[model samples]
Target: MENYKIPGHLRLETRRWAKKILEEYTLESHHFRMLVKTCEAWDRSEQAREALAADGLTVVDRYGTPKAHPCVGIERDSRTAFFRGLRELALDVDAPEVPRPPRTRDYGSRR
Candidate 1:
């Protein structure tokens, strides 16, 4: 059987959202592509930033400096929210609205 896998960040985010404490969401292909670009800016930082913004992600690094590169710094919680919203938006085929599931137990819960 072929082992299919989502990107690391995507998978982490998905698990995080499954737990809740995250509500609203907004994610688009353009945004995802922007993330890719941000992660690839080791050479062309300025160029990557311009391209990312054109693609649309509003990316900022941990240092609060304007990001000028491509990266996939998406954490667990945020990753899930982003992808969920992106999926919904794609399905709606008009204006993407992220569907919110009620809060649930955290990972390794016995509740």
Candidate 2:
């Protein structure tokens, strides 16, 4: 996949949304492409914001899931690992989203 760049200083959630676009667009082309269009509309045209807001969408990530770039577990030296074999850089989409399952884990007889 080609490295598509976007502003990195935006809030984590918004960057996450854009990260979603960069990561999944190849697999889920239609769905993600539409979301990309929505993102473009939100970014490019002023009027589309009103329409999106009217339809209950925000320019930022709809789900306010906190995320970290390059993440916590990825080894700092693994070249083939994501983050393009480098540490935290502004325009790298290499960090995959770490999976955080909801609070559904059973503590098993908390006493």
Candidate 3:
């Protein structure tokens, strides 16, 4: 099996996504779904860098102090090497398996 190497920035982005919706933010399901889809499209680590560049954002994957695009203008008193640590941790978490709903079986007996 091939080793899946996720880019640090992508892991940071995943953290950003989690922060945006997890708990405090409480992002709506629709918005979360969209984010999930977007993440799926840019699943590769290298893709994270490209995606950020395409969006005019510069991200440095530091262990504790991941930086977003400069345009965001967010200040920080402290920094860590872990880029989006929460998100990176979340990536390993198991997602709930959603089983497909049963298909409608037409019963002619009612007719």
* TM-score, ranked from best to worst: 2, 3, 1
For each candidate in the order shown, give its overall lDDT on alpha carbons. Answer: 0.42, 0.43, 0.45
Clashes of each: 9, 0, 9
> Which stretches in model 1 have alpha-carbon errors above 4 Å?
1-82, 90-101
TM-score of each: 0.19, 0.24, 0.24
**Model 1 score (lDDT):** 0.42
> Lowest summed lDDT over 10 consecutive residues: which window, candidate 3?
74-83
Q: 1-111, model 1: which lDDT tens digit per residue?
A: 222222444334443432231123243445444443333322233344456557555556798876633422333333455455545335336653765555666745745
Tens digit of lDDT per residue, candidate 2, span 1-111? 555555654445656777875775453444344444444433333333344446443233448754432322222222223233122222335556885456546656555
TM-score of the candidate numbered 1? Answer: 0.19
Better of 2 and 3 by lDDT: 3
Best by TM-score: 2
Candidate 3 global TM-score: 0.24
Clash tally for model 3: 9
Residue 58's lDDT within candidate 1 is 53
Error of 3 at 31 (Å): 1.4
Clashing pairs in 3: 7-45, 62-81, 63-81, 63-82, 63-83, 64-80, 64-81, 64-82, 65-80
Better of 1 and 2 by lDDT: 2
